[model samples]
Structures are given as structure tokens and as C-alpha cells.
Target chain A: MIRVVAGFFIVMVMISAATVYSLKETTQQLKAHKQQLSADILKDRAAIKVLRAEMAYLSQPARLEKLSRRFLALSPARADQMAKSVTSIAGRENFKQVAFPVDEFPLLLPQEKPVFRKKTVIRQPRVRKAGFYDRISLKLEKNE
Target chain B: MRSADLHIEGAKSGALEVARTRLIVPVSLFVFGFSLLLVRLVSIGLFEDISDRVTRRASAKTEIIRERVDILDRNGVVMATNLPAPSLAVRPSLITDPQEVADRIVRLLPDLNRTRVLNKLTSSRHFLYIKRNLTPTQVWKINALGYPGLVLEQAEKRVYPQGRLASHVLGYVDMDNKPQAGVEKFFDDHLSNPERSNDPLYLSIDVRLQYIMREELERAMDKFSARAAAGIIMNVNSGEILAMTSLPDFDGNGAIDPLAPEMKNRNILEPYEMGSGFKTFTVAMALDSGSVKLTDEFDATKPLKVGRRTIHDDHAKKRFLNVPEIYTFSSNIGASLVIRQVGIEVQKDYLERFGLFDKPVIELTGLSRPILPTHWGEIQSMTVSYGHGIAVTPLNMVTAIASVINGGRLIPATLIRKNKGENITSSNDYPQVISPATSRKMRQLMRLAVEKGTGSFARVEGYRVGGKTGTAEKVVNGVYDRTRKITSFVGAFPMDRPQYIVFALFDEPHGTADTFNMATGGWVAAPVVGQVIRRIGPLLGVKPVMDVKTEYQNLILAGNEKK
Candidate 1:
């Protein structure tokens, strides 16, 4: 009986030691994950600053005016041309039919209706919660 | 023999018991020590791990390094930025042979003095700087030499890619990490402080508009053989300075070569007797004080003499002239008579109200105070009425004229950008300097000037430009030099609803055949202002008013009918 009691005590100490080792490993993994997230946040902040600057550069009035003149063949609206539609409102009905405002006539003209066709069915990706060691293994597999 | 045997057995047993006791004591002590060591190892491995992690994180996050902030234009165009560079340093204590390393370095960097490098390397300090701002290729070449005690440190150096395009506005930074001039000096604190995460300072300048003005001004400077030229375009409503160029400017990245004394910034720093531009102010003062109406007439047929000095118009109109005619003809005699009718005290008070007597307190440095008369007497007031015997910067004159045209509220000129769609009403805290009616009359009279007077060259079709021209002879050695003149033009565009005010001035402009050999304001400066307006108008979102009637025609017709 005394021999059995000694053997049981040794087994209990060994189990407790293994539990402590696993707990320490988990804590280290948590720290590394937190550090990676923080790094990602910093990178995202830098990218956002760059994107905003690029957007501002692209939206500059002088550049937009140049692009419009080149690509769209648009020019600054003449004052008399802007007043022509309004003056037509005070004129006869035949005049209105003959010279309808370009801005307002877009709605009156027949337009092609866009057909909404679904290509691939939308679905959410499957999310799996893996342990630290399993995540390492999965990452290795992806690398391979 | 039996008794002796029995005594030996007893002694042997006693020896065995003593040995057993000694062995037990040492074994117990060993067990205790092993357990204590195990406990200590467990404590360190598990409990102390959190604190160790925190220390590692703290050290990792502590980047106590200085980095330079970027300088951008209003539209976020990079004007000045700090690029990462390598600089050579030396660990003096480790340098066993200083002369050997210096000889090798001098070959790679010929600009460095061999003796100076040797002395710095042989110094007693742990570290010493040999040279700063080395290119990547130079750094690699020097490091490949494999000299002992040599080190390379990462550094940042400023670069301006636009070269001399916006030099005066986006000033240069020095080696000591200090801004020297222009917007660089104006917003130095904002640029230096890293903790300021507020949006980067935005200027009201447009780079394209700045390019146009600088290009045109350069052409005029070359064409007219002028000593120096300065131009400014301001949004009359918001007091935003769109473009300001002072020629003979240096590149922000290049070494500042010496400049001539007269080629300084004549817009804000050098005050000049802005000849006839002061007529607008005189007319505004007379109209605001109710001393003279737009219909009031003055005798400008001959030169008017006051206190042994005669004030003459460049183009003599020997007839009774209305207020519009006086401004259109740029009649100094008529303007002097108008000031006399308003009296000296009122004229002085009006000038002070227009911010002409004080230094221009804007975002820029190097502002010079206006040279006002020491004592306000009849002769002083009369000559000052037509912009003589007093000197003020072109910026001051433009701001004053902007206030006169933009509904008579004096808004201080600002380089700071305003938010889009925000209300930009003039500052109402100050008293109204002139009534709306007087402001309208002044605009009409200025329009008349551009239509049929000295400012005729300033006209742009369908833009309705209005302005006054000034050609003041530079006072040399206390006597006005008739040949050396400072010609300038101050004008506003789309006069029916005035939007922008443009002013251009040429210092000591010589006569050229293209100008009909006449280096007057109307011939030289007015055309530059007109070109600046035409180029910058589209960039500033100011469209030409094609349908609006020309107000100049009606004003001229009214004046002619009265005659």
C-alpha cells in the first residue's frame, strides 16, 4: 500500500507540471498574436494616409478640368447657352418642343434598362477556430 | 583470547553506526537544496514571464527618433519632404591610424578636406561627424573601403522637386533644420512639432495659377529689361492670395547665390511710391465722406500749383472733369483738388483706416512699414493724395483696393485655406469704411479707367476688367529720377460682381520697342496683369461673364453726354 501511494503522488506531480507547461505556451502565443495585430493596425494607418493624399491629388480642380476637356470634350458653359432654355420656357409650345433643355430631356428620352443578372452565387467563407499549434500547422500547409 | 574477540566485535558495530549517521545527514541536506532550486526555477519560468513580456514590448515600442514632417501645397502636392540619406561619422577612440582613413575618404568625397577629416577622426570623443547628406552610392563606395572606426548613420535631407517654380512662396530649409523664408518660415512651428496631428497647414495658393503667373512675369521681366518684377492675384471675396511671385527668386534646393540689392521682394518687403494707384483711395475717401459725388467736377485743364509745387496730369485734360474722368485720365491735379475739398484730416484718417500707414500684418515675414508723412500739412496731404512723397508695399495697396471694391469691408489678407462651401463673409467687427453706394461708384469709375484711360491695355474681352495704372519715378539721392521709373497696375476682374484683384509692378523698367519704348505702367505692368488674369481665371473657377453688359460703356456714355 505504501508503494502504491508513492506511485500515485509521482503521477500527480507529473500531470501538474505538464499543465503548467501548456499554460505558459498559450500565454506566449497570445502575446505574439497581439503584437501581429498591432503591427497590422499601424500598416493600415499608413496606407490610409497615402490613399487620402492620392484621392486629393486626383480630385484637384485643374486636373479634373483638363481631363474633362480631353476625354469628355466638355467646355465651360456659355452664359447665353445657359439662358437659352429658360428663355424658351417663356416662348411658344412649339419652341419648347423644338428646343427642350438638354438636362431635362435626358429623363424624357427612351433609355436602355440594365438587366441585373447574377453570375456566381454569393456565399460566406467558412471560418474555423484552430488552436495555436494547429494554426502553425495550417500556415505551413498554405506556404507549401 | 575469547575476551579480546568480543571487544573487537563491539567496536566494529560502533563504527558502522557512526558511518550511517554521517551518510543520513548529507543525503537529507541534498534533498532540501534540490527542492529549493526547483521552486525557484518554476517561479521564474511562470510568474515572472508577464513582466518580461511587458519589458520587451516597452523596449520595442520606444522609438525615440525624430522625423521631419512633409510640406504640401493646398492641393496636397508634395513641396518639401525629408528623404532618408546616409552620413559618415567616425568613432574617434577606435581610430588607430586617422591619416590612413582620411586619405581613403577624401578620394571618394573630393569635397571633403583630408586634413579636416584626419583631425576629426583623431579627436578624443567617442563619436564625431565627418560629413552629412551622402548619397546611397557614395555611402556604399566608402563603406567598401573597409576602414576601421568608420560608421554610417541614417539621416534625412530636404528636397524640393519643383526647383525654382514656387521658390519664394515655398521657402528653403537650412542645414540646421530651420525654415528660412516664405511659407516654410511662416508655418515653422507647425512643421517642426511632430505631436501636432491636426491636418497639415493648407495654403490658399494654386500651383497651376502660380506657374502661370511666374511664367508670364518672367517673360515680361526679360522682355522689358526690367530690374525686378512682382505680381499678386487675390480672391477679393475671401482675401485668399492665389499667386504672388517676386522674380530673381532662388531655387529652394540649390545654394542661395548672392542677390542684387534692388531684386528683393518688391511686393511685401520693399515699399515704393505707388504713383497713381492712390487715386482710387482718394476717390473712395471723397465719396465715403460725402464731400464729392461721382458727378462732381474739378478743373483739370492746366497744372494746379499748391505751395510753390505744381501737380500735373500725364495726359492734360484742359476742361472741367467729373470724378470718373479724373480717375480715367489719372489726373494728379484733379485728385489733389478732390483731397483739398475733403480736407487733410479726413484724408489722413481715411488713409489710416485703409491700413496704409502700418506694416502689413500677414502670414509672411519681412513686411516693411509704409512711409507716412511725419506731419500732415497741405503740401504733404496734396502730394500723398496722388500717391507721391509716401511709399507702401504693393500688397498693402492691393488689400486696400480689394476692400474698396468688395463692398467696403476690410478683411485682412490670409494665406490659410478655408473649408469648401463655408460662408466667407467679410469680417464685420470693424466699422464700415465706405458705404455700398460709394463702393459701387468707385468700381464704375475704375471700370471707366480701364475702358478709356491709362488702364486700356488691362482690358480682356468679356472679363470686364477695371483698374488704375501707376508710374512713379524712383527717388534717387533725394531727387526723383525721371528716367528710372517704378511702373505698376492694380485691377479687379468681372467688375459687375468683382471676384479677383490682380496687381503687377516692375521696378526700374527700361524702355523696349515692343512697349513702343514707353516703360509706363499701362505699357508694361498692365499687360502682365491682364495675362495673369486670363491664365489664372480658369484655374480659379472664374468663368467669363459672356452675357453681362459692359458697365464701362455706360459710364463713358454718361460722361460724354454730360460734356
Candidate 2:
């Protein structure tokens, strides 16, 4: 029994020692990972700064204005060209209503349509009211 | 029996001696184990957190490679930022051979002098800097050489990408990472501190509006042959300066001169008489104080004599002009007469209340104070009523005008962008500068001026442009130079409810053939306002109705009844 208790204590010490070693290794790995992520973030931040400066330089209004005039044949919109809404131009009964505003907005919204859904695109010939469909229809009619 | 007892006592003594010897080994072992634990505790106490040590080392490197915050426009356009610029330095003691190292480095960096690099590498000093602000490719080439003595110390360089576009506002920094002027100098504490440098400084300036304003002002200056021109477009209610430009601006990316004409941020720094634009404040103060009524007429038939000087009316009507007529014609005689009835003390008091008597507090450096008269008198009041004898900065004038036309609340002008999802009007801490009724009346009078009076040149189609015109003689050596004029026009659009205010002023503008040899505000400045409003009104999302006349008929009809 004395020898058995001594062996149990020795096993306990070895287990505790292993747990400590594992914990230290995990902490070191975590620390190294955090450092790597931090370094990547710093590098990305520097690259973004350079890119931002480039973007501002490219999108400057003076240059864009010149480019638009040369390439797009667009000019600053006139006040009279603007309206409050689509309904201002036409009534609800008119078929030729103002659908969308025709301005040079770079970002156009997606269309929202409420039309009836077409069930099938494939065209099929009439089945002459025969066979299983004809019998099912007759039974349903009698029941009704 | 005695012999047997002696033998048992001897055995007991021997067993006791054996137990004492065993006790010493266990006690000494415990002491050794505890001592080992104590050393471990001391080492851990010394090291503390490993992350902290790494951070400290990183910071030591970053001190040389400083990180300065970027200044961005409201739309995240980077106006100013830092680029990683590697600077080359050397340890002379570590260099085994100086000449070979210098030759190899000089080959890679042709800009560096071979002699200087050799001398630095061979110097007795432990450390010496060789070259600075190297491109990434040059640094990579030098790194490939694998020289132990030569080290490329990394640092950051501040760069203004917009060049001369927003130079006066962005400011510049020195090689030592010191801020010299503009927003850089003003917000240095926030930039240099490590704990709070992550976020970019967002300004209220919109790049598009700024570009347009600058283009228009430059065009006007070129056309009129003016010495200089300045313009501002501001959101009245929020006190956000959408665009502000001063002509002859310098490139921020180039070499700077603090004393150059291009460096002067005239809108906020310089004070001028502002000519007839001052009349708006006089009329507004009179209406707000209940000293003058909109229907009351002032006899502008003759110049009003005060003490030794006479207040002359530009484009004299020589008739009894109503309040609106005085504003429409920009009558100095009429303005002075109204101030006479309004009293001189009240006029000074009103100007003080409008924040015109002191230096305007804003987020920029070198803001000069307004030039106030040493003594206040009847003549001073009369001249000041017509925009003389008292000089104030254009920014102060715009601030006061914004309050008068923007529901009568005074909000500070700020370059910093307001917080997202935050409403400036929700803050009840702002003081009411004028009554809403007074602001409404001022808007109506300004519209009447633009529609039918001397400001007729300021009419933009499909938008109700309300404004007043001022053409002041440039003061040279404490005397008015008759040949030189500073023509200025201040206007608000959609006068029924004003959203923005535009101010354009040209200094020392010469009369061109197009203007028929007239350098007055009516001829020079009014057309610029009209053109700017017409171009930007639609872009600003202000719907242009064909029936602007009918919609603002109430404001205009009220004035017509008095006429």
C-alpha cells in the first residue's frame, strides 16, 4: 500500500507537469499568432493609406469634370431638369408615365416589378380532355 | 535485571540518533525546493507580461517610423496622410570596410554623394545618418547587399495628395515630424498621442463643392483681372462650410512659404469693410430689435451729412425708398438714415451680439482679430452702416448671416465632420441669435433685391435667388483707393426657406470691356452668384419648380403691397 500511494503521488506530479508544459506551449503559439496578425494589419494599413491618396488624386473634381466633358458628353444638370417625383409629369391613368429619373446617377437602384408570374414558358398542345385527367374532372364535377 | 534495563536504554539512544540524522536531510531538501520556487517567482515578477515587452519593442521602432493620423474630407477622400519612407543610417564601429560599403551604396542610390557616405561610415561617432526618404525599391536593393554596419531605419513622411486644392486648410509639417500650420498644427495633440490616433480626422468639406467653388472663383478672377478672389459655400443651419477657396493658393505638396500671398487663408484670416453686405446685418438688427418696420420708408433723395463726412448713396434713387427698396438699391444714404433712427449705441450693440467685434474661433491657425474702430460715434455708426469704419472677417459675416437666414439659431462653424446619426439641431445648447420672424423677413427682402433691384444680375432661372451686393473701395495706406474695388455678393437661394448661403468677393478687380468699365458688385460679383446657384442648385438636390414665382408669391406679395 505504501508503494502504491507513492506511485500515485508520482503519477499526479507527472500529470501536473505535463499540463503546465502544454499550457506554456499554447500561450506561446497564441502570442506568436497575435503578433503575426498585428504585423499583417500594419502592412495592410500602410497599403490602404497609399491607395487612398491615389484615389483622391484620381477622383479630384477638376480632373473628373474635364474627363466627363471630354468623354461622357455630360455637363452639370440644370435646375429646370429636376423634378420632385415621377407623378409630377403624368397621372396614374396615363400609360406613358415617368418610370425612372434620367439623371447621371452613377449608382442606380435595382428594379422592383409587381407583374403576374407566368407559370410555364414551355407551350403544350391541348390533350383533348381525355384519359386520367378527363376521369378526374368528371368525378370532381359529380361530387360538386 | 539491572543489566537487561541498561541494554534497552542503549537501544533507545541508538534509534533516537538515527532519527535525528534522517530529519536533517528532509529539512535541507525542503529548504532547497523553496529556494528554487523563490527564484522562479522573482523571474516572473521581473518579466511580467510578454505582450507588454513586445509592444514596448515595437513602440521603440515606431518612434523612428512615426504614424500620423490622416485628414479626410466628409466623403473619405484622403487630403493628407503618411507614407513609409525608409531612411538609411550606419554604425561606424561595426563597419569592417567603409570605402567598399560607400561604393556599393552609391551605386544603388545615385542621389547620395560617395564622398559623404564614405566619410560618415569612417567617422569616429558610433552612429550617423546617410540618406533619408528612400523609395521602397532602393531600400530593397540595399537590403539585398547584406551589409551588417548599414541599417535602413524606417520612418514616415507626411504627404498632401490634393496639392494646391486645399493647401491653406490642410497645412504642412516639417522633417522632424512637427506640425507647422492649418489642421495639422491645430490637432497635433490628437495626432501625436498613441492612445487616440487610429481614427481619421473627417472634415465637413465636400470635395465636389470645393472644386466647383474654386473653379468658378478662378474663372471670375481671370476674367476680371482681379488681384485675388475668395468664395465660400456653407450649409446655413449646420454651419458646415461645404466649400471655401481663396485664389492664388500654393501647392501643399511643394515647398511652402508662410509669408506668400498664396498662403493667406483670407476668408478666415483677413478682415475687410465688406461694403454693402454689411447693410444686411443693419437691416436684420433693426427688424429684430423692433426699431424699424418693413413698410417704413427712408428718404434717400440726398446724401446724409454727419459731422465732417457725407454718406453717399451708390446708384442714388433720389426718392423716399421703403425698407425693401433700400436693400434692393443698396442705398448707403438710406442705410445710414435707418441707423440714425435705430441709434448708434444700439448699432454697436447689435454688431457685438452678432460676433463681429472679435476674432472668429475656428479650427485653423493664424486667425486674426477684426479691426474695430477706436471710438464709436455718429459718423462711425453711419459709415459702418454702409460697410465702412468697421472691418470684420468674411467668415464672421457669413456666420452672422447664416444665423439670420437659418431659423435664427447661432451654431459654430466647424471643419470637423459632425457625428454620424447625430442631428445638429437636436442640441438645445445653442442660443437664439435672432427671431424666426426676423429671419423670414430678411429672406423676403433679399429675394426682392435679387428679383427686381440692383441685384437683378443675380437671378438664376427656376430658383428664387435672394441677395445683396457690395462694392467697397480697397483701403490703401488708411485711405480708400478709388481705382481699386472689392466687389462682393452674398446670397441665399429658395428664399421662402433658405438652405445654403454663398459669398463671393473679388479684390482689386479691374473693369473689363464685358462689364462696360464698371467694377461694381452689381456688374462683377452678382453674375458669379447667379451662375454658381444655377449650376449647383440641381446638384444640391434642390428641386427646381417652374412655378417658383407662385410658390414664393406670399413672401414677394407682402413687399409689393407696401410699394
Candidate 3:
């Protein structure tokens, strides 16, 4: 009877020790998890700030107006133009090619020409006949 | 011998009874004390656990954690909010080599100065800041360095996605995380807490209308080379501000130097002598007093001299002018003559009733009171009749105009959304300030001004717009400067029922080639109001009326002969 009572008390002590240890481990884990969640919340808040700044920068009126004119082919409404025609053609045409100059012409390079051989032979023969008559007259004059 | 044996046995039994009796009392006392302690422990620890839980929860600071509030447009577009961000910090004492850590950090954060980072890391302080607000990828790269003592602290910052679109209305927060202007400043206390029961402030501002007004006003301001400009669009019935804008405004995240003087909010804070816009009030006072009828005519042929001051009409009638002609031609002489007939006492009462004598009560922080003439003599009343002797903020003028057109209901301007189930029309709360008949007559006179008078530029194609143009010479050192003018225009659209009141003002607008080099309110400010109405009309759910003559035929005809 004495041994049985002693064994029951010892078993109760061991069980109590284990429960306390487990509870302590769980409490530590929970604290760490809470800290991590807090860090994550902070990170998210900072990201929101960055995205807001980027949105503001991109949504600026001057930038949007430029983008609309470039991509959507939008133009300011002219006071004289009728509304129906303006709306129809405003974003339909490709403005890139429309702005190109259509009146410009390409420059041409100069070319060389060939000479005729028949004309050259006739000039040589006439020069030889005139030289012989001139030489004979010059010899008679020198002798005189 | 048998009797002696019996006597000895009895004596032994008696001794045993005595021993048992002594043990009984002490044992019973010990058992009773142990049981009492056990019962007390169980009662305190288990039975009252809920009360203990309540106590612990009350003492905890779990609710104090900073949480961001949502800022939404009238259409529920998210304008401002908070998101998480990782920042780099370090436990300096635990770092093995400060130089190595700094070099690695510089490689990851190229914007960081290597020398400065090294110095911070080498400090003996337990915690040192290496960089702030790092991107996730940058933080990941820094973490991969496997360096000890590195810490990443998390923080929240304000964000404005619409940028400068509504900068003035959605004022920016300072580095200390305090809202500084516009709605942000006006609703800071409610936005800063999560546990508070106050609902989020819902403004009457429509972002789309705001954008349209900003775009059109910017274009006009640029075209006119105006020094500064401000505009407002108010619901004439509810007195809700649909859109309000002032130029030279900074983006929410844009750097604002504290020393710069240009950061002032011109719409609510700046006071100007709002020239001829006051004519509406003066005329209203005269008509309301029964001193002058619509048919009553006054001589406006020449400048009227009162005491030492002379009030001249910009467009001289040089003949008898009736009520419609006084407003249509913007005759200063005629307005003065009408006010003189109304007398000083009546004029003062009307101006005070219009809420012009006090500082405008608005939700925003900055507000300026109108500078009224000190001495209330005939000259002061006459000049004020033409909007020269008094100066008021744009907001004050807009609200007063709204009151006149909304059938005389003086609704206090508010930024917070009205609670449901609350009766909005309870006389105990909101009382009618003006009669519907007076409102209708004022609408007719305003329409006449726009149709044939100085506010011709305010006329929209389909909308029956009515307005008054005011071009007052800015007073410098108590003397009116002829060259510097504060040109302003205030108008209400669909004059038959009068829904929206739009007011635009330009300070010291320089003459532009398109304006025929005229910087007067009729030439510069009226066009802006017209454009604002044209762009914002559809956004505010006000459909354009193609046939204006059919809508307000009776009232238009009653005031038609002068036009």
C-alpha cells in the first residue's frame, strides 16, 4: 500500500513538470509569431506609400495629356470645327505618318558622256594637207 | 481473586480511551485548516476566471497599435492609404566588421553612402540606422548577406496616388506623420485612430469634377498668364463643394520647403476685393428692401461722386438704366445709385445677413475674414455696393451666392457625411434663410447679366447660365492700383432651377494676346467659369438642356426686354 501511494505521487509530479514546459515553449512561439506579423504590417504600410507616390507621378495632368496625344491621337477641340466630325476622326488616324513631309524630292547624281571617233580622223587629215602647202610656201619665201 | 482481575482489565481499557480522546481534537483541527485553504485557492483561481480575464484585457495596450484609415473619393476611389515598408537598421556592437557590412550594404543599396554607412555601423551605440524604407528585393538581398546584427524595422508612410490632381484638397502629411492641409488636416483626429467610433469623413467633392475643373482652369490660367488662380464648384441646393482648386499647388508627396511663401492655400485663406461679384448682393438687398423694383430706373450716364470718392461705371449707360441694365452692363454708377436708394442701414443688414462680415466658417483649418470698411458712411456703402470697400475669401462669396440661388436656404458647408436616419430638413436644425420667390428673381437678374452684360463669356451653349463679373482694382497701401486687378466671376447654371454655383478668380492676371490684352474679369475670369461649367456639368449628373428658352420661358421673358 505504501509503494503504491508513493508511485502515484511521483507520477503526478512528472506530469506537472511536462505541462509547464510545454506551456512555456508555446508562449515563446506565440510571441515570436506576433513580432513577425507586426514586421509584416510595417512593410506593407511602406509599400503603400511608394505605390501612391508612383501613381501621383504617373497621373500628373501634363504627363497624361502628353500620353493621350501620343497614343490616342487626341487633339484639342478647335472652335471652328463641328463636333460630329471632330470626334469621329480624332483618334482614328495614325498621327505618326500624318506629320511626315510629303513634298520633299530626292537628289540625282551627274553622269559622264562618250566621244565619237569618226570626227577625230577627219580633223587629222585636214591638218596634214594644210601643213604641207604652208611648208612649201614658207620654203619659197625663205629662199627669196 | 476474580474481582481483582476484572478491575485490572477495566483500568487498561480506560487508559486506551483517554489516549484516543486526546488525538481526536488535534487531528480534526489540522484537517479543517487544510480543507479551508484548498477551497479558498480553487475559488479565487477558477470560479472568478472571467473577471480576471477582463482585468488583463483592460490593462493590455493591444489596441494602441497604429492603424491607417482609408481615404476615398465621392465615387469610392481610394485616394490615400498605408502599406508596409522594410527599413534597414543594425545592432552596431554585434557587427564583426563594420567595413565589410557597409561594403555589402552599399552594393545592395547603391544610393547609400559607403563611408557614412560604415561610420554608422562602427558606432558603439547598440542600435544604428543603415538605411530607411528599403524595397522588398533590396531587403531580401541584404538579408542574404548573412551578416549578424542586421535588423529591419517596419514603418508606415502616407501615399497620394492622384498626385497633384487634388493636392490642395488632399493636403500632404509632414515627416512627423501629421496631416497638414485640406481634408487631411480637417479630419486628422478621426483618421489617426482605429478604436474611435467616428466614421470616415465623406466630402461632397467629386474627383471627376475636380479633375475637369483643374484641367480647364489650368488651361485658362496659362492662356491668360495669371499670377495665381482659384476656382470652386458648389451644389447650389445642398451647398456641397463638388470641386475646389488653386494653382501653383504641390503634389501630396512633393517636397515643400517650409520657408517658401508660395505654399499658401489661396482659395480659403486669401482675401481679395472681389470687384463686381458684390453687385449681386447689393442688388439683392435693394430688391429685398422694396426700395427698388425691377422696373425702377436710375441715372448711370456719368460717374457718381460721393464725398471725396468717385465711382465710375466701366460700361457707361449715359441714360436711365433699370435693374436689368445695371447688372447687364456692369454699371458701377448704377449699382451705387441703387444702393444709395436702399440706404446705409438696409445695405449693412443685407451684407451681414449674407455672412460677409464674419470669417467664413468652413471645415478646413485656414480661413480669412473679409476686411470691411471701418466707418459705415454713405461713401463706404456706395463703394461696397460695387465690391470695392469690402474684401472676402472666395469660399465666403460662393456660399453666399449659393444661398441666394438655392431659394434662400442657408445650408452650412460641411465636410463630414451626414448620418442616415437623421432628418435633414428638420426646422429645429436647418431653417430657411431666404424665400423661394427672392431666389427666383435673383436667378433672372443673374441670367440677364450673362446674356447681355459683362458675363457674356459665362454663357454655355445649352445651359441657361447666369452670373456676375467683378473686376476690382487691388488696393495697395490703402489706394486702389489701376494696373493690378483682381478679376473674378461667380455663376449658377440651369438658371430656371439653379443647381450649381461656379466661381473663378484670377489675381493680377496679365493681358494675353487672345484676351485682346484685357485682364478684366469679364475677359479673363468669365471664360474660366464657363469652361468649368461645360466640363463639370455632366460629371455632376446635370444633363445639358438643349432648349434654354423653353425651360425658363416665363422668367426669361420677364427680364428679356432689357437684353
Best by TM-score: 2
DockQ scores of the candidates: 0.06, 0.26, 0.05
| Model 1 error, position B348 (Å) | 0.8
Q: Model 3 compared with the native: what TM-score?
A: 0.71
Q: B105-149 in candidate 1: lDDT tens per residue?
A: 899999999889888988888898888889879988988988768
Report the lDDT tens digits of candidate 3 across residue range B103-196: 8888888888888898888887889777666777987887799887899876666776676767777777886568877788888878887754
Query: Which runs of model 2 end up more than 4 angstroms from their true locations?
Result: A1-19, A92-144, B1-66, B90-131, B141-150, B420-428, B550-563
Q: Over the stretch A1-144, how does candidate 2's per-residue lDDT look in tens digits?
A: 985897688668767876676567566645665666676566666566677677778777788878998899777888777766655655644446646554332422223322466888857865664544345445656999
Query: Number of the top candidate by lDDT?
Result: 2
Indicate the DockQ of the complex predicted as candidate 2: 0.26
Order candidates by TM-score, high to low: 2, 1, 3
User: By DockQ, highest first, what's the ranking?
Assistant: 2, 1, 3
Off by over 4 Å in 3: A1-144, B1-65, B99-119, B122-124, B128-131, B196-199, B418-428, B550-563
lDDT scores of the candidates, listed in order: 0.77, 0.80, 0.74
lDDT (Cα, tens digit) per residue for candidate 2, span B443-537: 87888788877788889888888888888997889899999998889988878778888889898888889889899888888998888888788
* C-alpha TM-scores of all predictions: 0.76, 0.78, 0.71
Off by over 4 Å in 1: A1-144, B1-62, B97-100, B123-126, B257-264, B421-423, B550-563
CA lDDT, candidate 3, residue B198: 26
